[model samples]
Target: MELKNKDNNSNSGNKQINAMTEGNPVRLILVFAFPMLVGNVFQQLYNMVDSIVVGNYVGKIALAAVGTGFPLIFMMASLFIGLGIGATILIAQYVGAGDIENVKKTCQTIYTAMILGAIPISILGLFLCEPILNLINTPADTLPMAKQYMMIIFAGLLGAIGYNMNTGILQGFGDSKSSLLFLVIATGINIALDLLFVVVFGWGVAGVAIATIIAQAFSWIFGLVYMRKKYEVLNFQILKFYFNRDIFVKILKLGLPTGIQQMLFSIGIMSIQSLVNSYGSDFIAGFNAANKIDMFAFMPIQSFSNAVTTYTGQNIGAGRMDRVHSGTVAAVTMSVIVCLLALVIIPLGPPLLGLFNSDSAVIESGMIYLKNVMPLYVLLAIVFVINAVVRGAGESVVPMIGAIVTLWLGRIPSAYYIAYNFGKEYMFYSYGIGWFFWLMITGPYYLSGKWKTKSQKLIRQ
Candidate 1:
């Protein structure tokens, strides 16, 4: 298996994305993960800005109104997002093995699928918005604004979906830096527009939604142009769409389980959201703000986990199982170190929550959630990085099963039981409980070495 030096081809003028098959595992993983971490932070800002602007200008009800729509949006997008992850995994493997031809085919297949799928998703989402909100028992005071914000967002779903697909495609190439650039563009635009629409023009929730969609649209289109110009393999002709049946089948096999997992995860969050809603608008706003802050603690590990996936994929494709194992160790170690940041974040909870809204009830409610979940963040870090390694090895189903066991069987049910019997304040404990279960499931499977054999059939394809 003589490998090509294609990933570092200077003559090809496409060395923008580095190959992970060479270099020190720890250093390479760190270098790859850093840009992605920065990008993830900026990406999180889109929502953070929305929350900040809406909570300050339009009031608490409006803040809750915007916050209430997130789970539905994520739920709606989860399937496609899963497919994107599948595409990323495939691309990383192809990049690792220097399979440039198949990488192009994957790009074509997933892009065509997303474009065709976005149409029906947007229309169907519009019709389902109010009904789903009602089903979730969204607070009455927040319902109208939530519905308005969501419908507008659904109409612009293509922008968000497209930009994310772009990220996934680039990520598969092990090109985290370019994705960071695109996110920076989107985040800057979002912040500027958030101020303009929500505060300056006083458009409220609708304004924030509109700004997000517009920013996403711009970033997606800009990324497309950049990729077309920079990477020969990814120079997809937008109008000249091609759907490779074989590639589509392969992607479906890898993506469907992950898609189901993501959908269930979103459903689990939505379930907790409904419980939060029952406590009133202030609690909902608080939970939303706290959740945003939680992402900052989680972001570094999440970035490393994503890097682990690519690291594992490339090394597996290169038939370097030893490097894959070493990479996993490096990634887990990095993640644990990063998770200690939660200690700092927990003590600063009140100040952080105050960034969204000045209300004492909101801040107090947020503190309850941070205290419950932050200390146990290490459990999630281990689970996530380990599962990423498994998934990158083309073993998607195992991670999907872990998600099912964690979210559906563990977290959601535990949240409901505690909220009903004990109190809503105790419900956030369900997250740590779920992460423990996830670690329990993931750690054993990795130790068993079962995942190494899990996806050979797909890889051989």
Candidate 2:
């Protein structure tokens, strides 16, 4: 009878098993990614909707104003986003290792971020808005509207910082679903407000900007609530309004590369936008529409990359090197599948482009742009997935350096040369050529197993 007592009474075993299978990895990836996909769609929708509203209601010049200002705003926003990336990575490692104390401390870094990153950018957005606009060579007709829109959006910089910080914290804790939910709610509100204010109320660009700021504020609130209620480790009581030097330095070290990468990437896009401006409004509108469509196709890749980064970060911290390797393989496989599907849908580019504008000229131009760029999705997917893996492994510096060098030295120079020396029509090649070149450069660095080695050493240090 005593020999029959074979059942294990330990709850630790059960907990470990549950943790291992919390959600099927594939299912978890999809669940985490779907909301982001929807949010991204809505994000693109708002921008596209803004263009449609303004182009049809206000005028093409206003539409161009909104479109041109996007890259500039993105450049400014990239700094905060970069800092958020740093926070996410550090939080993810702590989460993976099951270290609650560090997670709470990491959360406090948001205060540091507010002081060191957000406040400075917000001030720049307010005071330097007009001068920056002029420096970017904004057209005379569009300058006033652009300045109006930029100032209003920048006025709500605190909200943007809140959104970024909260999302990063949630993502680090393996709760991407909450972040996605907030995005969905915010995006829906944004669209409704956009229509009510811009179309019915005749508020123009300022209305659209106001709508976005309000929506972002709501997202930040929801994110805060979710963290307080759901995340057991994130303690609001410990949050200080002042900075912590050690935490600040750690956050900056991890985040600075990502921020620089984003800044440089935006700079590269601005450079291209400058070139497009020379081609006239038709090309600019077409380019903007095409870029929106590209964002849709790119959303899945971005989502997967985010998931992989978190997954890899946690596993690396847990010393589960086997899982880390497996997770990477899974991520790359998923990315390839998505990219392949995109290749089949590439021919539908014209139809998608037409949704943004019925103008035959714009549609034709967008079609040309998409058709030329679509086949490169496979390459892009590989590049993105690998970059995420690198970032997750805490080898951000190499990737950041590669991106800067490729974008500035390879892409920008080639773009200038092709557009000016070869022919304006050759500008599209610059995009493909840059991706192809960087893929080649990055592939070896990744394959050499350097990132994995470097990451192991980093964790030890």
Candidates in order, TM-scores: namely: 0.96, 0.90
Q: Give the TM-score (vs. native) of candidate 2.
A: 0.90
The CA-based lDDT of model 2 is what?
0.73
lDDT for model 1 comes to 0.87
Query: What is the lDDT of every predicted structure here?
Result: 0.87, 0.73
The backbone clash count of each candidate, in order, is 0, 0
Q: Which residue runs does candidate 2 get wrong by more than 4 Å? A: 1-28, 237-239, 344-346, 456-461
Cα RMSD, each candidate: 2.1, 5.1
lDDT score at residue 201, model 2, on the 0-100 scale:
98
Candidate 2, residues 344-459, lDDT tens digits: the string is: 55678777776667777777767656776777777777888788878877778877887887788777888889888876656677777788777887788888888887555543
Query: Candidate 1 versus the native: TM-score?
Result: 0.96
